[model samples]
Target: MREDFGASALLKIQELERKGAKLGMAQKILLAETGTVEQVLSILTGSPIRVNVTSQSEEKGVISREVVLTSDAGEPLIRARSKVYCRNLPPAVVEKIRRKRLGIGTAIFSAGLETFRKITKMGVNDGIPYRTYRIFYRGKVAFEIREEILLKGGPGGI
Candidate 1:
């Protein structure tokens, strides 16, 4: 658990494109369309975040990591995993920045135009606490992402 946990959620949805869509997922969805991680989390869940490492390692030439992102009170909000090829990144920036502390937008900014390749897969179940996704980035699979939205009583009462 991270000691940096912050406050209560006052999140709300705003109309975009006049379509009345809500904030969705932990990927670049909000980071690209709405705002930064903190901004998106605050408006969507109205909560501060604490991250816990689930698993991490270097394998087959990439750094793989899994993390659980939770609210200050311990409600799981997002579970994300990423495989990044640090060698493909700038050496100077790589040395100065801490990778674990990066948010999706920041990572994209750092990598420069690293966009999503496709949504490889997705799943959801009512009894479960999370929704899963598998996303890939372009070019020799420079990065791949798998994330889960862990909010309870998901989206609607349904």
Candidate 2:
């Protein structure tokens, strides 16, 4: 939540809120969903999604990355920032994550890892809607992700 969303994105969020748009079913599910977000977004939009890593850094065994999840048409859907704890994951899985070619969920699932999400927070703050959660593998916290829905057609269907 401390991350800057940039001026343009903040403007769009404010405008959507000003329009008094209602949250659609898809938006609601996004808020409460505990499953893979990429999968849920794909099903909701009826299109495959791709992960575009915006920036990444590693420090003290934690890998942090900022990414935008886009639809098949290349429309940005969700902006996410994740911190992966290397100590919580297997070496093989860590390698896949280091490659950064797949969504975090994709990497974990492809490796057939047993994981679950714990919602840490979800709500609109200063007109920006967001959800924050932690993914656990083998009962250890593996990743903490903060996501902001960026689709104008999402959130309130504007």
Candidate 3:
């Protein structure tokens, strides 16, 4: 892959990691073997990933937290976390969504209809929203989200 392509591919992989997808070494190798970065991107993102969100409010403060996962089955394959801030719609939250810190469902819920509209508008010109994210814990691959909307919507709309 070209340098930019490699970077894009890596970004997609990171996005998958953020979304709680546990990728084995073999999967990584397979991604490399796919040759075209677009192909790799397709494989990494072409499905919905899972996430969990939690929030708490006290007299002095309000706290929102999120966890992303690869599956809703038994245990999650991977995970990521973030603290929601006052903006309600911070770029960090969007970044977290892109990175998969917030799963697709949670992002949609957290972002609400307006944010979704914003994302759809942005996504129109961006080809597909591509993001880089990380995994806090690692594990074996148990399942993958097979839905395309979950995969392609990216972090912007989450």
Candidate 4:
């Protein structure tokens, strides 16, 4: 859990707009999209991304992980923290995540799980734009993720 998840420092896009916010194109995409961050980053960077799980743990029926997505050349592009409810996930999905072998999106897709993403919040903290979303499986939220875009211009100004 992040200390600033509830901080007033990060404001929603609508609120920012009312306050005259000027966001770059890439920032808008990152803040508004309801898709997988891995795919979005790949498209923006035009490179395959490697998922690096820095830490993972399970407690009280919840699995959590801190992850980074990097370009093939090893430049970090995004930082993400996700927590999945174990009860909502299939065993295979849980195992894949526990093994730290794939991004949360990939693991779910590889397991052939049908899911939908809902953007719960979007904000910028310390000049880094981020979005918090929930992935639903069988109409229940299986994953809660907050991803921070690390690139300044989102690679090649995309």
Candidate 5:
């Protein structure tokens, strides 16, 4: 039974790696739509302005903004948000990016699963308390999210 479980886990890891690559590609495409790394940073900074990205032919690509204003009681208010569109990107490129994003996601999930397995095994063999194991699992999830963000975007946007 243990051998079967191990084999299954290995297979999952392979699948995850493939998915992670796809996810990476997707992230690249999305970032590319912002024009430059500086532009992306600006958009993320909640500056109250609108940015309209355009293609080489001057066609509108995508629009980014720090706040979307709506009227209430005859007053305008800002709501922070950012968005991307397929129209701004080439169809082929969008498709490729989507595939890549999925791939990267898969890879990350596989790695996480593998780590969990190893930790669980150690806890079982060492007779560690179940409560301690649960704490480790919680820590793992928080660490994973942090690691993912860092890996996806370093100190600077690419």
Candidate 6:
């Protein structure tokens, strides 16, 4: 936990999930301050979830994806750019992740695994955006997440 930099709700979610707890960021935001996880998606949306997979690639023992989660109306909500060490995850979980069926937190949590997230950077990119977080599993760097939350057309955008 990086005191001044980290403490974002995303981090909290990451902390909980890494401790074998399930994540419901969409719901948690409603209950507390998100610290520094950026304030773009600070407001949760009820819109239909949509995933725009920017890219999916695998090299060596790692598999990564750059995904944008948006509303059905095309309002970008959250960006989850991540890389996972395939060899470190269960095959079933990997299959689900590849099929775009489970989220990084959910995938790991469901597999009875926890994550360690370290926020390397934070700032606004497109809509209150920036770069943040490196997710770990059992002390091994399993995934790195770069996120951007789009505000326009989202929950509070309207």
Top-TM-score structure, candidate number: 4
Which is the winner by lDDT between candidate 2 and candidate 4?
4
Name the candidate, 3 or 4, with the larger TM-score value: 4
Would you give me the overall lDDT of model 2? 0.80
The positional error of residue 24 in candidate 4, measured at the CA in angstroms, is: 2.6
Candidate 6's error at 104, in angstroms? 1.6
Task: Estimate the lDDT of model 6.
Answer: 0.60
| lDDT for residue 8 in candidate 1, whole number 0-100 | 9
lDDT of 5 by residue, 1-158 (tens): 25664464444434544554322432333222212222333344433323222211112443232322222222222222222233533355334323322221233343342223121211111211110111112224211110011113223422
Per-model TM against the reference: 0.55, 0.81, 0.29, 0.83, 0.16, 0.63
- Sort by lDDT, best first: what order? 4, 2, 6, 1, 3, 5
Comparing 2 and 3 on lDDT, the stronger one? 2
Model 2 segments beyond 4 Å from truth?
Answer: 1-22, 153-158
Cα-lDDT of candidate 3 = 0.35
lDDT of 2 by residue, 97-144 (tens): 788788998898888998988777766755456778899988999999
Taken over the whole model, the C-alpha lDDT of each candidate is 0.49, 0.80, 0.35, 0.80, 0.27, 0.60
Residue lDDT tens for model 1, 1-158: 53321110112122221333333444224323222344456556667776666777776556777877777788766677777676655554343233467554455566575554444443433333222223334444455666565554325611
Question: Residue 15 CA error for candidate 5 (Å)?
Answer: 43
lDDT by residue (1-158, candidate 6, tens digit) is: 46653246456556544655433444344223323232323235555566677789888877879887766688766777788888876688788788876566656666776666666764443324345667676787777777754444324444
Per-candidate alpha-carbon RMSD to the true structure: 11.0, 8.2, 14.9, 6.6, 19.9, 9.1
lDDT of 3 by residue, 12-120 (tens): 5666667666554434433323222223433454544445443323222223343434433423332323333323444544454445354533444454422211011
Q: Candidate 1, TM-score vs. the true structure?
A: 0.55
In candidate 3, position 5 carries an lDDT of 48
Rank ordering of all candidates by TM-score, starting from the highest:
4, 2, 6, 1, 3, 5
lDDT of 3 at 47: 46
Error of 4 at 153 (Å): 2.4
Which should have the higher lDDT, number 3 or number 5? 3
